[model samples]
Target: MIPVNEPLLNGNESKYLLECIETGWISSEGPFITRFEREFAATVGRKHAIAVANGSMALDAGMMALGLEEGAEVIMPSFTIISCAAAIVRAGCVPVAVDSDALTWNIDPTKIEAAITPKTRAIMVVHIYGLPCDMTAINEIARRHDLKIIEDAAEMHGQTYNGQPCGSFGDVSIFSFYPNKHITTGEGGMIVTDSDALADRSRSLRNLCFLPARRFVHEELGWNMRMTNMQAALGCAQLERLPEFVERKRAMGKLYTELLQDLPGIQLPLPETSYARNIYWVYGIVLKDEIDFDAAEAMKRLAAKGIGCRPFFWPMHEQPVLQKMGFFKDADLPIAAKLARRGFYIPSGMALREDQIREVAGMVAEVIR
Candidate 1:
């Protein structure tokens, strides 16, 4: 089967890893980790970047940095990975799901105002599928409410808004280094921000809340969320190739658009112009009601021909866990819910070649033909 994603390694990753091994600095405390953080901060246009064990931990640290009181509500898009909510919950905050815009598949910035309450402490906006969210509107609303904006920019490494990189716009932003990401370290994550306090807090938290490197000067309770030297080595190498990776992903997206444009009843997702680049981390397709095949049937048909297909993330408000909590009231997010039900993404890996794209395109046509 054509896999959903692949990690392309053209960096001096092996060399860096070998250097780490030679120096006996395989642990989180190593030169490459610091170098990775510094270089990444510069690349993303952030004041500081703190390396973490994974993207989820980066989110968790971001929430913690906000210092929300217990039960404080965090407004976020329902159409996002569970990691967004999981991180909020981990930091003793409640995840308040809001519907997103159908076009951008991003949190509806206009809807954010209504979700805010006296207890609402933060707003976490996710750039779903590497499509940039309406940051201008979102940022304005956040400023009016004196609310903190946390960007879950994991899937949008090279994406930007109004010339500002996604990770640099929000009050705090997180990036993922999983294999399928724009860049990878097998399994790693990073947090970036303009706030010195948040940056310092993140560094401390990732290293067990140690004061300037711990070693018995522990101040607050923290976790072992540090990224290892090995991960950093890969991350450093991946950084060098990130721009090309994004360009390749966009090229594939354009190809998919051409291939799928003529299909009746198949609605394609478009990138918002606000985004400097829409790197197609995954290509989402929505089958209209008039379509003969629903999302499930489409997936089954495609899989038979050795193609991989998957549905969108089930809206957080509809998930059984949240439903049981009675936390999910009438979310009024019709667009997001509908998209969740019928939307599915196909393979759009940067590593996928022209012939591979053609093959996947053919399989898609056959599935819904």
Candidate 2:
């Protein structure tokens, strides 16, 4: 059966890993790791990029760098991976979620003002499915309220908004190097920021907050979330091919839109025109309300046809952990709930074969035709 994603590994990846092994500094502090961070910073146009264990930890570090007190609220979209909201909570901050926009499947900036309170400290925006949010409005709201902007740009790497990178918009931003991301380092993450103090703090926090040279002093609490040199080796190779990967994903997105446009009960996700270029990480095709299938049933049907399909993420508000923690309450996320029922992720992997994409489109059209 066709899988939702397949990380394509080129020959250079193995070569890099072998080189790291030959050097015998394969832990975390090697040439590859240093070069990876520097290269990533240059790629994102940020002053510093701190390599960490995973995306969640990068987010937690960013939150910690904010120096906000416990219970400070950080507003984020309800419709996202649990990690986005969970990181805020893990950082001793409140994860206040708002509704998502139906068209772009991004945080509805229009709904943000009401959620703001005296306790609000930050606004985290996810560039969902590589489609950018209304940064103009989100930035304005943050400016008015003096809230920090933390970009959970894990799904967006090379995409730009009117010539500005996604990670550049926020005070601090993060990217995941999971196998499914634009570039894979197996399991890795990086945090980018312009502030040297925040970068140093984040680097310290990820490395047990160890002092510059004194290794034995217990200063502020920290975690060992440093990325391994092996991951960095792979990251270096992947970074070199990111632009091509993004272009391939965008091409597939265009193909899917054109191939399935005439099919009934199929609706394409609206692209954000404000973004100078869209990087389609997970291309979503929203089935019409009249369709007989919810996302689950749709998946089962697709699987039966020897094809792979995934349901859209469940909104954070609908999660069981939120209810158990009493952190989530009734919120009007009608669009999120609706999309969660109808939306499912199509195979948009950069390495996905064109024939595979075409076959998947054919299977979809067969069902909805």
On lDDT, the candidate that comes out on top is 2
Candidate 2 regions off by >4 Å?
A: none
- Predicted candidate 2 versus true structure: per-residue lDDT over 1-369, tens digit per residue: 888988889748999999988989789899899999999999989999999999989988998888889999999999999899888988888899899988888999999999999999999999898788889999999999999999988988888877787788889999999998999898999999999999989999999988887887977789999999999999999999988888888888888888887788877866447555557898888888778877788878889998788889899888998878887777668888888889998787767998998999998887765
Model 1 C-alpha lDDT per residue in residues 254-340, reported as the tens digit of each score: 899899999888888785464456678889899888886678888888888998878888888887777777767776678888888
| Candidate 2 lDDT score at position 38 | 96
Error of 1 at 225 (Å): 0.9
Model 1: lDDT equals 0.86
